[model samples]
Target: MTQQSLVSRRLSSRATRTFALVSVLFVTPFIATSSANAQVYTRAFGYASTEPGAFPTDGVLNDPATEDGALPARLRRTTVALTTTEAPGTIIIDTGNTALYYVLGGGRAIRYGVGVGREGFTWSGVQTISHKAEWPDWHPPAQMIKRQPYLPRFMAGGPGNPLGARAMYLGASEYRIHGTNDPSTIGKFVSSGCIRLTNEDVTDLFNRVNVGTKVVVLPKNGPHIAARELGPAAAEISVRPGLTPARPAVVTQRAGRQAMNIPVSSAQY
Candidate 1:
């Protein structure tokens, strides 16, 4: 081969290698970004925590107008099949599934997304809705206060309270079926030991069940079918991290009688 041709060939080889390296550099970031987006969009299970700075504008409980913005659509109230043998009016909490089902009979049940007790705090078994309250007060127990010193000793019932709209005491245990100001916590296991629902859902449930309603909490390995069905398509609300105070319900003081629209903040267990 001619000396000039040999030099030209070496230059061509170097040029090819340089082009390949440049192509890889440009494509790698896009691939990584696509993978991250896929993970976020295709997440079908619960979240560790809500996205920060997520909250309703008015800070009210269960304001239909505002609730849609704060909570994901899939996590909101839904109706599903009840394959269990439990009777009607029974309140069933599937902790493993992070869902609560109100048996409506005929193989149907109204389901609600919920936040169950964290790891060591979880429990299961039968209980009764021995008591129910609307806009219930929250007096954090001594133990809870010790664990979360930032928590208030007593939180009055109203908008911005941690225990959203309503609460139902579960027998004599420290736990209660209640509402949470943080709707983002739904479908997660972050609560101390209580079952939490959206304020709107709790109020709807509170009105339906009396003090003596039967409450059956399923075990961790319990029979549940909802989790397998829920997916990103169902989760319309995006999860926001950080603790933003939930919006409050609109209340009007008229004739010295306060007529309050439904929405709750937090409850104590």
Candidate 2:
């Protein structure tokens, strides 16, 4: 070959090699990201049934509110004097007030505004925290998916996941005390049945509590109203008038408190 032809051929070969290198560099990251997502799915849900294309490329499944404009000041987290016979470290969910109290003993508790179950979805009972997880994955229950077919069957946990920063599973039940992506949902009756707190509040609660923590969910129309009527000292009083007053019941001390007769509501996400 002529010298000029040899130079041209050598340049073409170099260009081809550079193009191959660039292709590998670009494609490798995409592949690694996909693999990492798959692994997360497997670890979270114990199965990788859904295809990668089914997930949002941005890693957020829902359109979360950019700001907490709807949140009310009263619903924000604060420490307050609470009068409850229940021991410290217990969680008291006053559904009527849309509030959660982490009993701190000595007439004090850390209170947080929360989103409780909507009208027909309210429940009352005592349950222990069976499990706890951070950035928990979501598998919308069958009933929820039936109601809202547009919801993803499974969503990997992140800022976009409805379960938010942390989750404390209440007993073996589907209900949980968890964080919410939408801060506006706090202090509202929006969930199907689960209790929701702002991500920051939930994270703080999560750090303070642990697995097997006692959770007392007062009825939707229960103690909080009576507390409002009688004062903070009446918080532990059961709403059922005929029943004798007693301490808020725990799993181990059911006989001490009047059993909540409210019907259990349906499970939520």
Candidate 3:
């Protein structure tokens, strides 16, 4: 073979290797970016499924106005002066006033209007958040299904789902602090037992809270210790005039049974 032909062959080989290297350098990041996008999609909206109704394709989820309408003026989320012994991250659900307070410590809290259980389903207790999920699926518990047989057996999380944007499971019970598709229910007594807030408010609270955060649900007719906005000067005011401030009963866990000093009811949503 001629030396010139041999040199030409070497040049061709080098050119081929350079082209392959360039392709890898350009394509690698594209592949990595696609993978990262998939992960983010899953984290934001949960896994995609092939099952029917698993994810509605009707475009309802994209309509933010329907999913989150304007709450009433009094029910809007706001900062308030709160006097409580609970720590900064504690959640206090005041069912009587249909509100939830995220204690910020230093005698203050960020109050969000919430929907509580109906009259017969009202409950009170202390529990710690056990789990957190974004766009969580819902499986109606047996009790709930019996109460409302017309309800779907299961629901995939989305703007249409009753448990909207996020959910924080409370303790071992079925109750959860979750977002709601119906913003009008924010200041009403409508839920089976789960405490619900508007999707916007719940997402804000969800980001601020973490797993294992303490939660105290005040009963419907119980003392409104955490709900009242006693000024810094009158921090020790009682539920009624001339009465001692009542403390919420502490919940105790036992083998197969939970006990509390106050009479408490349990419900699932």
Candidate 4:
């Protein structure tokens, strides 16, 4: 064949190869997306108001603010006096204060900072812990695909599992009190649904509470008030700047020689 003809044929072959590669690259992701949509992720957000959480989806335990906007990782080794009373083994979460209390009894509570559901998710209710687990595996539910189909279908419990160190299943519903890899999220609101705790805190709680323990979650706004009128949780003890991790604790005291002082109180003592 003439050299010119040979050159032309090679160019044609290159063009054909390039076209085939381009076609595959363009079509591959769509096919993959179709398959991904068929899988599950978390049950947190629940159905489209019509669907129930069945698998494939769902943490933070309570905060009124979005986690992204709030500073993370400030609460540590802090305990607050509670006005409400719970059984020694019960778990009480105050959404307004963004704190979770593992009622240690008499007066003191094992207080831990927490992150609640931000915005539309603020809610209040009283329920019991029907069950519990460690390093729990996660299975996404069907409804999740309606939002992000590309999410993983199943994830084992461990460092990577969003479920964290422990899980306390709630009601017949898909809600859970679970751990999170993002400890910074502990004091902020984030997550589609379900209460999230720091991995360390969850592990600590898992070792303490048993099945059938009571769980009380407060609401963000009104009308849908929490089931129990547990009283003011921060009445006796207070933190200022206030509950924000960004704030400093401002403890006030009154009374005689037995008065409480800043960062100190009698209720939890």
Candidate 5:
């Protein structure tokens, strides 16, 4: 073959190879996305929502401020060691470390990143998930309203509202384990007194938790030996009921002195 013709053919072949590689690169993500959608990673605590593309679009739960944001992998939901005798379905909040654990028995728990109270606003105590709500309405308590007059007196549940997707009210003290519109606040010390999880994380915990789920909040500066030692957990287990247990004396007094009387609200935006 003429050298010119040979050169042209070689160039064409190289171009074709390049095109094929580019094509695969372009299509791979879509294929992976399809597979991901089909086989969503089920979260612990029986979270019904799937991962990857599962952000809600409803006005109440989809906060535009955090639409594109993501929680750090460390803060995202994962099963980890939680060596507690607490029965499965119990909720434990490690406020100092910004982690929440949903005990699943068998020495495992689902840990989620959380935002806790700032300084004097912090509190610790045993509380029950007295109530659960999806897209719950927000009523700025008299105290919160006085602090932020610009905040609406009563905002119906929606995307921008402080409460993101789910709420697990903490007994009669007005604290709650709730989702936040501002996901950036996760893993920080910035709430009034309630524990804040990302919308997705809280929704997962909400699905598995019941009204009477015991919530133990470790005090700021309290020892979180188990939560700190946790690594990834293996195998899936169903939530089972066991003995209703006593409070660990180790976690009792962390928030005892600082437990404030703040009324329940969405979260501090």
Candidate 6:
């Protein structure tokens, strides 16, 4: 994330302008709360006092539109199949199930579908938001530029920019949780590697998180299949059993199954 934009830390003039001159009685109060959107994006996953954030990176991506579909809808309503309580405003990106979670206080979690890196770009790590931006102009990294010279140096924030609406810059790395123009690709194994969230969903999450939030990616926390749905694939694996995480709706790299195959052998019972 670039140095703090003047608009950051406080509500943007646009937001004020949008709500200004309102005739409603509760208008003033609403504006006060609206400042939250102006603040930087942070991760507050109910941790003690504080700890150093992981996956920190720098550099800005295009400003993504804050339209909608960015929040973790299902995660907001997930039921804990087993024990363990998720903290308030906690974020869980389950790549296995293509879901993102927004911990809402109680033991429940809001799960939203997500698109992750294809088989090769897959990885797991912890990090916090070191920067936040809205309508941020995007400049493809040197590598992306070299690969595609036709790419523009900077793309202003808008619907077309690859960096959809909102972006949370991870600690100090090139990684980020940002929105995308291609909504269809979401909830699938795609992208260079960064976690892709719906434009609407990212916007919602942007406002909820802060500049120092924690992000923990599990083995297969965001797969499309629930524990029950895994029956078919689980049985298909002829090697060893699949990775049996204590959680559900997760599909990870199983010990027995190969990446090229989708667990469809019938030699073993």
Question: Global lDDT of each model?
Answer: 0.64, 0.66, 0.66, 0.55, 0.64, 0.50
- TM, every model: 0.61, 0.60, 0.61, 0.55, 0.62, 0.52
Candidate 4, residue 140: how far the Cα is off, in Å: 1.9
* Candidate 4 per-residue lDDT over residues 44-144, each given as its tens digit: 33211111221222223223233223444334423444445567767877776676777756566666667677666556677787787766766544443
Candidate 6 lDDT score at position 91: 67
- Candidate 6 global Cα RMSD: 21.1
Model 4 residue runs over 4 Å out of place are 1-74, 222-269
Cα lDDT of model 3 by residue, 18-119, tens digit: 999999999999988876765553333222222233333323333334434466655666677888889999999988989898887888787888888876
TM-score of 2: 0.60
Q: Each candidate's root-mean-square deviation in Å?
A: 13.6, 13.9, 15.5, 16.5, 14.9, 21.1
Residue 100 error, candidate 6, Å: 0.9
State candidate 5's TM-score. Answer: 0.62
Distance from true position, residue 239, model 1, in Å? Answer: 29
Report the poorest 10 consecutive residues by lDDT, candidate 3: 242-251
As a whole number from 0 to 100, the lDDT of residue 264 in candidate 4 is 12
lDDT of 6 by residue, 1-269 (tens): 44467657455776776676564556767766554422211111110111122111111212222222233344222333212354565566677777766554444444555777666555666667778877454655555446455445555555555566668876655666777655655667765456777665566567778887777666654333232111221122222221111111111222221111111121110
Can you give the lDDT of residue 164 in candidate 6? 64
Best candidate, TM-score-wise? Answer: 5
Model 6 has a clash total of: 49
Q: Model 2: residues >4 Å from true position, as ranges?
A: 1-70, 225-269
